[model samples]
Target: MRADSFFGKLTRTLTGDPGPTAPQSGGTRPKDLRRARLNDAVLAGESLVGALLTDAGMARANLSGADLTGADLSRARLPGANLARTTLVGARLVGADLKGAVLADAELTGAKLTGALLTNANLSDAELTDADLTEANLAGANLTSALLGRADLSGADLSDAYLTDGHLPNAKLRGVDLAGVNLTEAALVDADLTGASLTEANLGGADLTRADLSGADLTGAAVFEVRWTAGTRWPDREVEERLRALSQEVEPGVWTVVGDTGRSRGLRLGD
Candidate 1:
């Protein structure tokens, strides 16, 4: 049944059997769709730049506004994939599963995504500048308003991450490592963690106001209800007796954004 088959013309244009939503991609499919399954494939606004698609499954695929620049998509499964506004510049996505992937406003500059699972991933307003994400899990991920400049995110888990209104300053984590990161409720306002190591990190309710944690290595860090101030740079030793029963000194260097914190902290960034 070779009726112009590129997976039968994208499975008859995503199973309406009328075809041509935007399906005339260059040379018509088969860009080595390795281990291809393509469940629920729509391939919206398709371009698929530099496609290899190793281990492709593409679960719940819509591929909204797809470009996929420099795409490899290594180990691609793409669970619940929509890929809103997708470009994926310099994409590799090594060990990619992309659990609940939407990738809102995605660009993904210099993307690698070393061990990508991206649990509960949306990455709102995503850019991911110089992205590597070394040990990526991104547990309960939203990372609202994510830019992530020079992002390496060493040993990344990011447990309980919704990360609202993060205007992390100082060139956005220069020489970023983020050692042993959990960054719970991460919104390290004006973040500039000089010499960032952050060992054994949890950082519950993180909102490090004017944060600069110089020579940063909060040994066994928990920092419960952290909402720091006094231009926060608590260099070690003022873990402050583990933040003196939970650090709180808000309303200094004023940075506020109370806009629908994913329905007042019920944060759901993916489907």
Candidate 2:
């Protein structure tokens, strides 16, 4: 479990050239793969079979299309890595550093990403259903069209994240900081947002049906075609009155409202 042994194995695996002292394939040898220091390891398109990478540093590594399913990468440093289309299902990445990484179309179902740093990461069209991202830093991340259904994002920092057309149904977002996030046309049905901050967030045409916003801050939020119920809260009384006055029930369980009082009428929801 020495830190240097893990890095040596990872280097040999990435380069596709086994070193002189490297262990043979399918051997019963116990390699020390814990706390590996593998900075800039090129593991793209490689198949990592149940590798132990706990507390490893693989920053700026090229892991595109790498198979990391069931890998133990907890507390790993993977900042600015290219992990596009990588298979990370059931992987443990708790407290990992993945800032500015390209994770587009990656499969991260049931992965533990708690307290991970994913700032400015490109996660567009990624499948992250049921992933645990609680308390993670996703500031300025590009998550457009990503499937994050039932993901745990409670207390996560998502400031200025691009979440346009993303699916987050029933996701836990309590106390999350979503300032200036672009959630246009996103689906957030039944999502929990108790005490979440959405100051100046662009939620135009987003679906928030049955979402809990008991103490959320939505000052200057764009609400064009946004759906909500009677349980949804407004930060101020004046804003609540404005919303009530502007909202008009157009159909059963559906309401309509005007955005900026333009010529066209927007949409909302009703209880």
Candidate 3:
């Protein structure tokens, strides 16, 4: 597909006209629209796969359910855009600004989003398996129930992010900041969290079976009802003592951490 075809579709969308029917696969590739001013464009549900929109200005655009798979949007300004349920698999979004964007349930498997600015973005239930999000600014992003299996999130800023019930098995999260994040009942089996910070984060009922926690800082973290297996690595002996003091063995090879508020709310491991 030629690059001009993508621009033609964009023109049609801007003029309030319907674009041509998208191909079955490998849609039109957009030309270099670097620093292109495209604010408030109505591009919802369009197929622009492999588009080159590097450093483009796309603030407040509506791209919900759009097929942007494999699109190159590096260093683009996309603040306040609506990309809910969009298919961005294998897309290159390095250093892109996506602040306040809505990406709930988006398919981003294997996408490269390194160094992207996603502050306050809503990405709840997004599929991010094998995605490279290293050093991405995801502060205050909503990631509830998101699938992050085998994703690389090293040096990412996830401060105050909502990650409740997320799947992160075998994820690489070295040196990541998760301060004040909610991770209730999240699955983190065999995940590598070396040097990660969970300060003041809520890990209630989270499964940490065989998860690596070497050099991690869990100071002031809420580990109530957290599940731990034999291979669950602790930061140190003192931290383990604190965890055991606030927990009780519900059954053999199963423990339940409880809060100090005299409440009976706790979850049994391996249940």
Candidate 4:
């Protein structure tokens, strides 16, 4: 973790501590800084722990509140980077591009970010506990109130993502596509999300308690006041017997999906 090079453009006379200076982690050893260009680098709150910065270009870099714990930043481009509240615990950032990156409240515990692009990234309230983000794209990402416990995010895309009030307990999210995601009240406790797609997803007031939505998908997903107890595992038994025989429970853990269901029922179940 001792690679560094100026190459140029960290500026304020190439980071001799003028434009922004916070990196004082003992007798610094940085050398090599693979592919270092450091475009727009400000290096805010810089510590850059375990820094190597592989392929660093750092486009629009601010590095806000930066610690960059265990940093490698593999394939780094860092498009529009600010990295707000950045710590990046156990960071590697495998294919980092971070398009439109802000990373609001980011800590990114155990971060790897396998195929990170993070399109339109903001990552509101981001923590991403045990993060891996296997096939990450995060289309239109915001992830409001994001914590993402035990995060894996397998094959992630998260189309039209906002993910309101996101928590995502025990998250793996296998085969994640997340079509039309807004997730107005996302919690997703005990999540594995086998074969996840989440078509037309809104899931207003979503809880999904004891969640295991087998063969997951919930087409035309509004699922108003969605709570789901009795160990929820739909997408079987004729779509939970046609959502308990033609979905209607105006109160008490309301899960309504009345119309526009059949197109082979583009389901949006979970785990």
Per-prediction TM-score, please? 0.31, 0.84, 0.86, 0.35
Residue pairs of candidate 1 with colliding backbone atoms: none
lDDT, residue 113, candidate 3: 97
On the 0 to 100 scale, the lDDT of residue 197 in model 1 is 61
Candidate with top TM-score is 3
Look at candidate 4 and tell me the lDDT of residue 264: 18
For residues 151-260, what per-residue lDDT tens digits would candidate 3 score against the true structure? 99999999999999999999999999998888899999999999999988888889988889989988767777788866788888777666677677777766667746
Which portions of model 2 show Cα errors greater than 4 Å?
1-32, 230-240, 260-271
Local lDDT at 229 for model 4: 54
Instruction: Flag the better candidate by lDDT, 3 or 4.
Output: 3
Q: What are the Cα lDDT values of the candidates?
A: 0.67, 0.82, 0.85, 0.77
Give the local distance difference test score of model 2.
Answer: 0.82
lDDT leaderboard ranking: 3, 2, 4, 1
lDDT of model 4, residue 190: 73
Per-residue lDDT for 223 in model 1? 51
How accurate locally is residue 118 in candidate 3, as Cα lDDT from 0 to 100?
Answer: 97
Cα distance off (Å), candidate 2, residue 122: 1.1
Against the true structure, candidate 1 reaches a TM-score of 0.31
Separate clash counts for every candidate: 0, 0, 1, 12
Q: Model 3, residue 175: displacement in angstroms?
A: 0.6
Over 13-128, each residue of candidate 4 has an lDDT whose tens digit, in order, gives 43553522544365343433666788897878767777778887989989899787888898899998898999989889989899888999989898998998999899899898
Clashing pairs in 3: 225-257
Instruction: Tell me the deviation in Å of residue 57 in model 1.
Output: 13
The segments of candidate 3 whose C-alpha lies over 4 angstroms from its true place after superposition are 1-6, 9-32, 250-252, 259-271
